[model samples]
Target: MTRILVVGATGLVGREIVRKALRDDRITRLIAPTRRPLEPHPKLHNPLVDFDRLPEDAGWWAVNSVICVLGTTRAKAGSDQAFRKVDYDYPLAVARLAHRHGAMRFALNSSLGAAAAPRLLYSRTKGEIEAAITAVGFSSLTIVRPGLIGGDRNEFRAGEWIAARVLGALGPLLPRRFRISPAPKIADALVEAAIAGASGVHLIEADQLAAD
Candidate 1:
């Protein structure tokens, strides 16, 4: 049985993860901290919290694994600095705290183009977080990088909507790496990685998320 903490429980991919994890027998408990409440589940401990001011010493931090899908677009954040705080800082903070509390597994939801080298602010921030989290020293670390995610989102993203349309029309014509990654698939990968607690660092890329 695994006790797992899921950050970003309200987001698109995060929602999928929570749904699956609650139904998974391997998970004995799920601790999710969100700005708002989630539907009550017997196995879930939902804590309403501000990510900027998380309770560092809370007992809920004592989990076997952590899945961090927290992210926000620059447009939604209203500035690049704000975006970094969400996509980079918050996730890293959660990782460090979880590790400190004896969590041995970590799974991160990243983007397709994330890299440490200079590039788009979004990609750079993702890369930096990946690096920062790695330093947290979880025995099992999994990073999943998916392409344009496809799912019904609670909020509208004009850019992703337009891109999804274009990519949907292309479909199988595009390489697997460029195809739209289903939100549920990404969530499944994160949950499985956390539960399995496989040793060493593993990278699950866009192509791997697709069904054969």
Candidate 2:
């Protein structure tokens, strides 16, 4: 039986990941942690967590794999430091805990152009987190770099909504790397990667994510 842990369960990508994982027969259990609590499900368990101060309980980390979809925009986070805390610190912390608790695989939802030397703070933060998690020595690491994700979001971000609508209209005319991929497609890819049991880091680009 495969038990999985999903962080950022309330977000757009995270929510779909949980939904898909719950339906997968391979996943015997799904542990979802969020800042705000989520409703109960037969195969899913929700844990309320404080990002700044995660609980000491080791139970949640004792899963087969850990998928991190935790992220926030600069506008929503209010500052670069705040955004880094969510995009970098919190996810890295979860990765460390998951590794220590015996998780073999770690999958993350990163962004396109993530690099440690980038001028963009968001991309740099994500790169740093990826490096940090890699250092933890997980047996398998899957880093998914999805471009402008298209889906109904929990929070109203006018920028994202406009971008999605615009890209939706443009369709195949847009660049493959810049195209808007569906949330459910990305979620499906994550589950497939986990189930495949492929070892080592796999960098899934926007085109590959959209193809999935």
Candidate 3:
């Protein structure tokens, strides 16, 4: 019976991860905190939390592993700073709290081409967040760098929707690394990584994530 903490449970990838984890026999309980409330579940405890200001309760951090699929685009977030707050700050804060509350493993849903050296602001921010979480000294850390995620999303992002449709049509022509990754696949990988009990840091690229 493993207790898990999931952030951003309202998003596309996050929602799938939550659904999958609930069905897993290995998981005893799931503590999912988001800005909005989710449907009630027997194995889930959903708490509405503000990303800019997390609750001070230390009990919220008690879990076996922390899975973060939290992210937002500039258009939705309104500005670069707002996007960074969701993509970088919120996840890092959750990781820190999880570490303090005795969680051992952390699985992050980072984007492709996330590098500290990159000129792109989004990439740089993601890379920085990855580095920060790694430095938190978790017993095991799994960083998944997925390409364009293909799934029914909650929010309306025209660019992503168009990309998914176009890429889906040209699936065979697209490179394996750039292929649209199903949310279910990524969710399965995250759960598997936690169940495997692998130690140290692991970087799962797009191809490997898709295969999983």
Task: Identify the candidate with maximal lDDT.
Answer: 1
Ranking under lDDT, best-scoring first?
1, 3, 2
TM-score for each prediction?
0.97, 0.94, 0.94
Name the weakest run of 10 consecutive residues (lDDT summed) in model 2: 188-197
Across residues 89-199, which tens digit of lDDT does each residue of candidate 2 receive?
999989888888899998888888889458889888978988898898988898888989888876788888888888878888877888887888888877777666588
Candidate 3 — worst ten consecutive residues by lDDT sum? 203-212
Model 3 per-residue lDDT tens digits across residues 51-83: 778885658689999999988888878998999
Q: What is the C-alpha RMSD of each candidate to the true structure, in Å?
A: 1.1, 1.6, 1.6
Q: Rank the candidates by TM-score, best first.
A: 1, 3, 2
**Whole-structure CA lDDT of model 3:** 0.86
Clashing pairs in 1: none
Error of 1 at 125 (Å): 0.4
Model 3 lDDT, residue 205, Cα: 88
Give the candidate number with the greatest TM-score. Answer: 1
Off by over 4 Å in 3: none
Backbone N/Cα/C clashes per model? 0, 0, 0
